[model samples]
Target: MKPNLSLRVSQHLALTPQLQQSIRLLQLSTLELAQEVEQMLDENPFLELSSDDGAPEPDPQAPADATYSEATNADQISAGDENDVETPAVDTPDDWEGDGSMDAAVEDGEWGGDGTVRSGSGADEDEADAADLARSHESLTDYLHRQALSLRLSELDRAALRFLIESLNDDGYLEDTLESLAVGLAGADDAEQLDELVHRFTVALGLLQSLEPTGVGARDLAECLTLQLHAMNLHEEGDPAVVEAALRICRQPLDLLAKRDLRRLSQLCATGEEDTRQAMALIARLEPRPGRRFADVERNAIVPDVIVRKTGRGAQQSFSVQLNPDVMPRLRVHDIYASALRGGRGGEGHQALQARLQEARWFIKNIQQRFDTILRVSRAIVERQKNFFVHGELAMRPMVLREIADELGLHESTISRVTTAKYMATPQGTFELKYFFGSGLGTETGGNASSTAVRALIKQFVAAEDARKPLSDNQIAEMLKEQGIECARRTVAKYREALKIAPANLRKAL
Candidate 1:
């Protein structure tokens, strides 16, 4: 075997550190990006937030020819693909990424400040404050403990109750047998002691079950429902007969209730079909996961990357895209540090400071490029999905990453990076950028319809459907066919399931 050296031209892509940072920043969600910025601010003295007032003002200390100015240099932009890992040769002036600066200026304005493309700011501070409360919700045990304080229980009983409360899972289920908890307190050395411990546990269990949620400390689903029924009975809630019937139903195998077998349930409860239906309805209103609300149900702390707003009214009505100032970290280089480094008066620290200064420039420029790419992509999306904005998801046209990438003169991967974890707030709702792109479905007129539109249509059909005779997937497919869309029964089923709609049998009202 011999090794030969030959001259061959080969092309390769390298992910430089700056390019990698750009990609990372692009993919981070609004909240995550804010978190990353805070971390960077703490770690790097070079990076600091630009004014919250919306525009990156040129540093007063900077010379007229400073490389790190308000706007990036056109020549440098042409040289750095900003994305070819900075390949300017393939970039066009019309492309968003070409100049490495945002074409549209993002002003700090309220969400509903301007109609079709723009929506009201649903993420106001009040909602955020409420969400913050939810974010810091107390554990179920702590909640139960507070409720226990109002009761006049002995110290031993209160301790046992607290222990029981702690033992309950986040879902409020007590999975372990009383014998297990008893053994922990009363060793296995003596059966009599264990029996006494079990008796005390039995009493504690009753008090624990009496908690506000009604079903807390329930051994199983059946017992949980029974405990709730007894509480309802004590409070004289619901029709006496209906409450009685629900208790009887709960006492039976829970699987029968879950299957929604009205026939079997009625037969087992020895009640008529109508009575069984009423009983099922009452049971349906009960909360299965009692502690779910108390659990740290982290509400998505979303701040949109792009905001679409309505500009004009009537015939002149148009939507414009802009970066959200809230999500876009107003970052600028630290003035004092940059000036000292530039003056060359900060001796021995000049080299390290210079590197940090350069890094700061790259970070700010990359961030600027990120927003510009996002704004351009958003504009193209708005242009393509204009009908969707006007008429809702039903009018959303077919779109793919390739279409946007081709239109913007960007690689599909770059488009993907820009779309991932990035959200845009529009009149309809705040949606991830990827939500706007969907594969096409064939139409009767040899055209194409967005799968999103098809799903929207299916949702409408299901919502308007009769409860007594719910539409099946096959029927839905036939309905789509009537509307000039070619969809299969299985495809309809898939979409139906995606919308979290139950099957026809399950959807049918008793």
Candidate 2:
């Protein structure tokens, strides 16, 4: 048999750089995207925060404008694409008059619409502003450097300390190997001096964990909690029941402890039910992941992509949906740079330069496509779940990716991508774009309730239940049936778990 040499033509989809970026940006949580953007800004000269324009102008009463810009900037920057992404324009407050101001404001707020931010000025305002600024947090590295200065160390030792501090991750763990630390510092001096410098890191590590939130500089979850417990003076003498229980709990899988298995835990700790419960309670207070706090606090604030407002006509009500403008990034490539590249001014690196330019352009274009897709998906949600806007989660109808995809005349995968990690702020609360899409639970009467609505209803039942006999998953399922939402006890348990609610026994009162 001869190998075929004849060419046969067929088309296949290729993952372009821009498309890849869109997929990545879509899936990234707001915090991850912010970090990625910060890193990108460092690597790309052309890419910068929209506010790198200037220190934001001072405003005393311009809450509306400030809110507007913040929301708009978040939308654009967070969307992560440059081309074809249309930022919905903000409506000036001037258009909204008298009682309309607050009504408009509430409407905007409900839908996460762009509006001016409230400002502070004057002596009183300055004091208020200072109080507000006090909440601003320092980076982990900055805090470590400040703490390190108080330690009495030689110049060489201090240098090593700084290196080790820098190497500590957000959780306060020494992620870098000592060998790598030595290599990194070797450039400053000879191998002998570098080894001495690296040896000094142990002292720094001990001190780093000793800082606020303890256990931050720990090597892992065990060390982090242990360090924190030690710092808190919670770790005590041998057979100190609380300390032993805490240690035992931490040593095992955190999930088992999270379940608060009173019986199993009592057996493990060689204690009675009361002692086991107490130990479990104490262990619950310990931070499982110390770094999560830093990552969460530093995360970018939510900027909704769409807003829906209720407008009434006579006895009838409807929703007015608007896309948020604040998160949009208004960017354009430098004309001079583009022209220079076209004129062959890049010389030897022209190919690389052109490639980068193409990437940037593609990035911008992909962002535009992302916005277009989001808009279509969001609109579909608004249309199908209009009842939800009018009457809250209780009125939310069953919806899924296929329903939206069919409505928008797009693929389910496309709908899935658009919904991934995207958020919408509503009167109900801030929810993932996907939250509005839920499977249906068929009712006895041949109708269906959204699984989301069922979850919400279940939560309401649990929250309002008697603590002495807190509603179990089985009980909750029964309650849902009373409300005409037919669901099983296991399904109730699943939803309860998803809401981070403990089991019936654990949720019960003392």
Write candidate 2's Cα lDDT for 69-132 as tens digits.
5445445433322232353432324432211101112221222111212111112223233223
Structural similarity to truth (TM-score) of each candidate: 0.79, 0.59
Evaluate all candidate structures by whole-model CA lDDT and list the values in order.
Answer: 0.74, 0.61
Cα deviation of 185 in candidate 1 (Å)?
9.6
Which pairs clash in model 1?
50-330, 80-86, 81-86, 81-87, 82-86, 115-310, 118-309, 119-427
lDDT of candidate 1 over 1-510, digit per residue (tens): 899999998655544466567777776776777788788788888777656344444455544443333223223222211122231122223323422222132211211110001111223444354356665778888889999999898887888888888899988999999999988877888999898778777888999888878898988888888888888899999998999899989988888988899999999999988888999999988888888777765554455777677667888777766566455555677766665556686556787777666666666655656666776688789888988888899999999999988887777877888898888889999899999999899999999999999999999999999999999999999999999999999999999999999999889887
Residue 252 lDDT in candidate 1: 88
Which ten contiguous residues of candidate 2 have the minimum total lDDT?
97-106
Highest lDDT scorer: 1
Model 2 spans > 4 angstroms off: 1-136, 174-199, 220-223, 231-276, 296-300, 310-318, 329-373, 401-417, 465-471, 505-510
Worst 10 residues of 1 by lDDT: 110-119
